[model samples]
Target: MVKEVQKRKINKEEEIHISSSDSSSGDEKELMLKNPLKWWSLQGKRNPTETKRITLPSTIKLIYVTLAFVPRLALYGLVFALGQCCRAVAKLFCSSVGAPHLANKRILYISDYMPPQVHGIALRVSQYTKYLRSNGHEVHVYTCCVESRARTSFDHPTLPFVANPFNSGNQISYTAGIKLAWALGAESWDIVHVFYPNALGLFVLPACRWRGIASYCSHHVAMDDYANRYLQIPGSPLLQRIMFLLYNFLYDACYRWPASYWGDVNASMTQTFVKRHLPLAAKYSHVATIGSGVDTQRFQRRIPTNPDLLWLWCDSQCASEREALCKRIGAPTNAIIWLMVQRLAPEKDIHIALDALASLAQQRKKMNKELDVWLVIAGDGPAREGLEKRAEQLFTNDKNAPGRVTFLGAVPNARLPSLYRAANVFLTCSRSETFGLTVTEALACGACVALPRCPVFDELYGHVLPESWRYDADDKCGGHLALIDAAQAAASIEASAWLEANPIDASWSAAAQDLDRQYDQAVKRGKTKYTSLRSYVQKRLIHLGRASLLLVAFYFVLSYYWRNIYCAAQCRIFLPSLPKPVRALCILTFIIALEWCHC
Candidate 1:
């Protein structure tokens, strides 16, 4: 009776919306208001007859540029000399604070992203730190603070920042170059693992070389996919073609120049990465993928379930809390919730999941299964407003009236496990992931997954999950057809109880052990026992053969063609500059300053 009253109230509201907005006769008003995206097409949000883009921010020209490259050699030389002096002083007086004993080494985890930022990289670093500690190694994390809420999740020092203009400030760690350099000069570590090659990596990796520390990286950014997304002027393919040079420069800067070694073992995967992502593959690429891991213990807690079954797993408190959550979210008591937790970015392709939901709703009435499907999207991003409106349109026919889709804004990571467990199936349409950490987290929480056809997904979960778990989709129609198939596959996973049979083996200890093994090998090879002058300069320039070459050519060209720019007073323009001998001698000295920076 109460539900009928609620339904009457919703119907009255719908009638008002139909009358006020559409201006159609009473009958057509109901029909028109039901399909929002279609209504949007009619209202010029999108026009099917003519190609029109979603109203977007004015395109910014993001072309990468290099300026005054040659003239900075003297600055590079002075910095290098000062760095050498600092390293010498650090070694002479500071006397290595935490000395490494046999097998177990003192490790430093350096990254631009860590907790309070809330992303995959942050989670990875936190998990690695925790597990590495459990492995009896002393591990410390140095990263930017995104908030001041007093993070009990992980312990570290404070002072501030890491910024991501690329990700629209989603990942932030900033003004930390000097702080990190100071740390490197003051303390010592066996290994420093950088999670992202943000601006900090530009010189920090070089500092690692100067200090005789083994610096490693875990590659997370997929720039080839990212470059095309951001570095373009809409409706100008010609300008975009020119922008490829910038793309190539950034790819080299971010992926190639940053680290000496990264974790990756698949040779075929490396070749595929080089073929697709690289502008030009380096002749020497390291391949030893230790692989990323998930903390199973974090997700093993039982979510609030039925009171009758509370004793079987969770206590009465969990049941009470979960009931509160369901009531708060307006979840249908008997409905099968398909939860998706991710930042609602366009690249995530959430619309596909909505289309899939629409298809499932129709099929549920006709099919014998009679699914009570609900989609709960827990996230917040720039795309949230549009997605919410579209989702409302998609679930317009939901008998519950307020809609089957729930938009839970910006859920904290601490609450994610409960959401994962309460959810029947974890669904995602993201094809741009370097590593889909959420998928692993969902699996760890015992929720089955439905993922898009992505290479990284295939490599990581191909063997881990059943054949039906992953599906392919079309760009023309998005993932409507394919995600329905994925949903059906997920139903099968639920029925067969696959998660019960095969538990995931992504323990952090195993990952730490792999790092320990790599460190042992590096130490055996006599890495970082001493920081020398020749080795410090030579190794960096040699490793980045092309940057070294570019640096050399830049200085050479400036000295040859643009000599007067540097030596205006030294050169005599009919006695307006120095004598030929003095000028030549000064230019020679200028040429010599470029020596330390290049090969």
Candidate 2:
């Protein structure tokens, strides 16, 4: 009974997660990769990579789209200036600081999200921590209490768009500031690495400054897009206009609130970001390792499965176990398993896959083709219930869907290999992935993939996956069918050749190595203040500006809510018996109280 309880407790904690390097690090290769514009040459194309734009409400589109980037630009300026000054100071002060001690360093990770939260940040931290520990690093994870998935409900309707006022998306641990402040002060750590920057991760920046520790702020997600993505009201053209108006307020609240964006070294998940906009991110931006190192090793590792086929699972035995896996997941034994492993979030664009699958079924019927394809979703999120309903609606309404939906809710990390091995083709309708760990895992299992026509995917897989493998995300009507067809084509190609063409090298140890280099640099530099008064003055101004920005953001949220509440409620509080100013003040106070209560 105790063992079973412990097993359940363990199951409650584990969750799915997060990146990729641009290219090889050979001196010439590094130079070529550093200029992401030339990345097209690598993918057997001459065209440069381009960033996709997320359309926002026109009210603040000018500010959010045009002016919102100004802050990030200013941040980049600060980092570059600080980096140059810091480098010179380190050279002068610690010229004899000697080689960095890559091993046995004390590390502290501050994040609101941690394993077993089933988030990419949690898994990224877990995997990297394991690598660090194995290499003799003493690491401590400081995070808020991880809530159980069962305790949370993911059954909310998505069409009308229920979301946070700030639009950070769901499943965030908000109460951690006091706990993290205490933990940072208690530990005499060498390095503090932050996984999620929107919350407690931001607290580490100042704490590390005071403690004189090296700090790293990882930019895992492009979060500004979340408001527009999740809070989308697609019912009517008028509803979409209202959605646009609603998101403008949400963006105002979220923009300057994130302290992680101001860190000296921002680690990006992909090198494309570094290449295109922030060149300095290269030093901190590193790729997390894929499962095990070798493709064979990944398949060989499993949990509570058939022991005889454990080692050589990816070989011939993978096919034999496919039938059993289908049975386990309630999928048709003869069905072509199309697996999508990700948190079912609005940003994931899962409905696109469903829609595409529905179209594929219809097209196949029209052509009299036989394809029994089942989309096996292997993760859960706040959007899961809505997604399930959407799938159901698609199946019922379309009727020609090739196969039914099989939701294997949050499959344990260990069993992912089996699922991947069983899957005939991997499908991702999400265009928002930085570099999906699932994509790499699927390829390792020798499965074909259908990728969206997003810049990140194009750069990462453009060279490897065939031209037909790409599908238009913006062109949603026939795009999904094209993606499905591509996946089918991929399955027909030589597996060995396919794996070779893929740029699938993400060593967790290599990520650790990058961290070690940063650690050594920070240790050697110590906590020296910027020597130049001019730079110091610039810093103070920027610091004050950031504070002002925060206050302005708070004001914006308050003012927007105040106006909305007053208008929406249709308050007629102008008392003729009372003084005009007094009545105005009373109404203002009431609005403030209402907004606070809502918050």
Candidate 3:
């Protein structure tokens, strides 16, 4: 009775209600195996191996475009463009945005969008915003509300959007650029932080420079995720090339563009980011490992319960895969409780989980044993329908099956902590994860995890958990059999026994503490930089003080000269008030003057 009560308690804590979904694990593996750079080259003929020189035609085109813009507009553009070149100098002069240690520093937090979007990058952005603001930094977000499948109802009130380009196919980015310029001028910001070099970030970059604000770029993902998630399909090679160029351009902008760092929070993701961008990024910038952190307080274990033989799976792509894995493991019905929590996406490879479960049922039938198990699913996704259809077909066909699979879709994040507490084990079947934040959350909740040996699984949890808690899909059938054997052995060894044999509470606490320490260190580092910048900017201000009057006079003279040229041109074009030869010579000389100034 005590064991059952303990099992029930663990179930309540760790039970994850995931939605039904189907995705191909095979496809995911294939995509993972390919070298992203080579694949990138194949898709767009981008020469990652060689330094492609910018052609004179491109430079000429840029020059001509600059000449076409109004002189005042051009001046603003030049200031912004020049700022990119002077970021290191600017940082030497003023505090960069998001650098810790400057009190009351106004930070312009630029990102594509914040959560509750289905995208991992978006969620990370949201978390960063939340933590930064909570820490008392004055932060603001500017992002495009583009029509995407992932956007949810969560809004960062402090970080409000100026506009959303969800419907209009027109160039929405241009409008954003105009708005960004206005924002930069309106506020006194210490630094402008661009999270990614996407459309929005690229657009506002110039505005940051024109304002003489220190800027930063956070390379948050491996460059490959962009190709796989956004640039899908074999065609669109030109777009790929353009993206690569833009990434390179942004890389050149920041004083120091930090890659997601390994051995930090989201260590696996940081490591992956480094691996993907190191070839291109290492050349120009100091690519350091600054990883995203988790709020351990929010995810920590709330109640102590004896660990049940709980199978907690999250990933909308895992339904079919989970079924297949259960069949392989031959877990009896009612004996095992398999929980699947995940998004419904083809990239997630969740169908493999379902398929694995179904296979388990077939094996149970052959043995003439009732598989006493419960499969619970939680979450929602795009592939919900197909996955549901599959679960219906598979389970209905199995007459001897004694177990039932339940779907509990889309629970609140607050509710998830309790679910983690109830479960004994966590399962992740996704082939790739930036860091698998949930996996760590489960670990925090004291749920042992089972996953393919992802970078996170291998690096973060390998030493902490038993060998039975992990498996690799790449391994042969024998290897899988070994995993099954280990899992079965682990099941008999009660959670209490496991805990006694391998103590991890101290390690978990230490890891969490270490994360906090890193956060402190980051803040300290930021402060030092900010102080240096403030001092430099103050020095520059002093130098400018002596020449302020002279510069003011020089500005008026330049403005008047341009005004006269504009009036003369207007008179020539609009009225016959000016002589033809005089108008023509005036225009020619004006162009020459503009060209000389540009030079």
Candidate 2, residue 414: the lDDT equals 76
CA error at residue 492 for candidate 3, angstroms: 5.4
- CA lDDT of 40 in candidate 2? 22
Kindly report the root-mean-square deviation of model 2 from the true structure over all alpha carbons: 23.3
Each model's TM-score, in the order given? 0.67, 0.59, 0.56
Instruction: Please give the lDDT score at residue 581 for candidate 3.
Output: 58
For residues 1-599, write the lDDT of model 2, one tens digit per residue: 11010011113212210002334335434434465333322221111011112223223333543453445434534553454455444434434322354457877766555555566666676667667777887777655433355122211111111112222233443323333444555435676776643444333465466445666666566654555554444337687677667655543333222332434445555666434333434443332312223233454323325676653324456656797877765556777777899976667778777776777787778988744777788886556656666676666444455236767677887777777778778888877676677887777666778788877787677876677666777764546667766767655646436654553565566766676777666555544432355446645755675677679888998788667645544544455566655666677778778868999
Look at candidate 3 and tell me the lDDT of residue 597: 100
Q: Give the winner by TM-score: 1 or 2.
A: 1
State candidate 1's TM-score: 0.67
What residue pairs are clashing in model 2?
13-116, 14-116, 15-118, 17-120, 289-506, 289-508
- Segments of candidate 3 deviating more than 4 angstroms: 1-105, 116-127, 144-179, 185-191, 203-216, 219-226, 229-268, 290-298, 304-334, 476-599
> Each candidate's root-mean-square deviation in Å?
14.5, 23.3, 16.3
Q: Model 1, range 369-480, lDDT digits (tens) per residue?
A: 5446767888875466567667666666455333667778788887888777777778988888776778878887777888887777777777878878777866465668
How high is the lDDT of residue 93 in model 3? 43
